[model samples]
Target: VFTLRLIHIFAIHKQLGPKIIIVERMMKDVFFFLFFLSVWLVAYGVTTQALLHPHDGRLEWIFRRVLYRPYLQIFGQIPLDEIDEARVNCSLHPLLLDSSASCPNLYANW
Candidate 1:
């Protein structure tokens, strides 16, 4: 955070009488800004359910969620028939799948 780092440096300067802190506040600000920017970018990028493909069967994204217990968690009701139909028509093959391929069979009707 440029704002936070600037304040930190400004405060540290007063405490130490204008000496460079152990870490450069500029670098700290850059790293903080980049970290939050990365998360913000990812959060913006991953909101679409169509982009995130979660396998109810093979890859088991639900279990992965339980294991990871991180943010970005989402839940929704999925019909059993839909999952079955998707398993029946998954011609794309499991090889081409990642976390961003749309929930399996979520759009089988399309």
Candidate 2:
């Protein structure tokens, strides 16, 4: 859907011809169906794995010992590098000082 939307935008800008735009729009439905099918397969696989593995405690141990600390640390963190800050905040209006309040950094901005 995003790819088709982007192609439509390019078509609007006259970078892509009408024939390609039509083909892309037609393929969007096929893409949507495939996406949902893939998601369903992933969910089915995970459920099957859980049912097959019973309660061995390994997953719980990994979550508690390996993932919990990093998850908490990542919850509310900011990058300290100047280049990173600039790259992130370039889309933001100059008056907005908070990094969290920055505008979306899109291809058009870059």
Candidate 3:
């Protein structure tokens, strides 16, 4: 009967339709994830720029760490002469940078 054939085709088409939709949705989800990742990468770059050069210490990306005495002493091992030279060199040098805020004159003068 025509009704039987119509019913059979409808069932087959119904199954096929969902598979097609699922495939399309999966592709869309993949595209969206990649798009989100790219946007996050851009956001990360912008956020890093903000964190790297905090003006008033309000940036959230700055990490706080308590430096123990020996840790500080062994880690940065700059001689007093070197520190003085750095201070003098940094004062006269003219490249304005964020990292140099800690040292009165700490830019690599090269």
The most accurate candidate by TM-score is 2
User: How well is each residue in 1-110 modelled by candidate 1, as lDDT tens digits?
Assistant: 89777766675566653444544567799999889866754554343222334343434554343333223322343334434553543334456544343344345332
Q: Compose the digit string of candidate 2's lDDT tens values, residues 50-97.
A: 443233234553343233433333454322332243555332434443
Task: Enumerate residue pairs that collide in model 1.
Answer: 53-101, 53-102
Q: What are the clash counts of all predictions, listed in order?
A: 2, 0, 0
With candidate 3 superimposed using the best TM-score fit, by how many Å does residue 17's alpha carbon deviate from the native? 8.1
Preferred candidate (lDDT higher): 1 or 3: 1
RMSD of each: 11.7, 18.9, 15.7
lDDT values, one for every candidate: 0.47, 0.47, 0.45
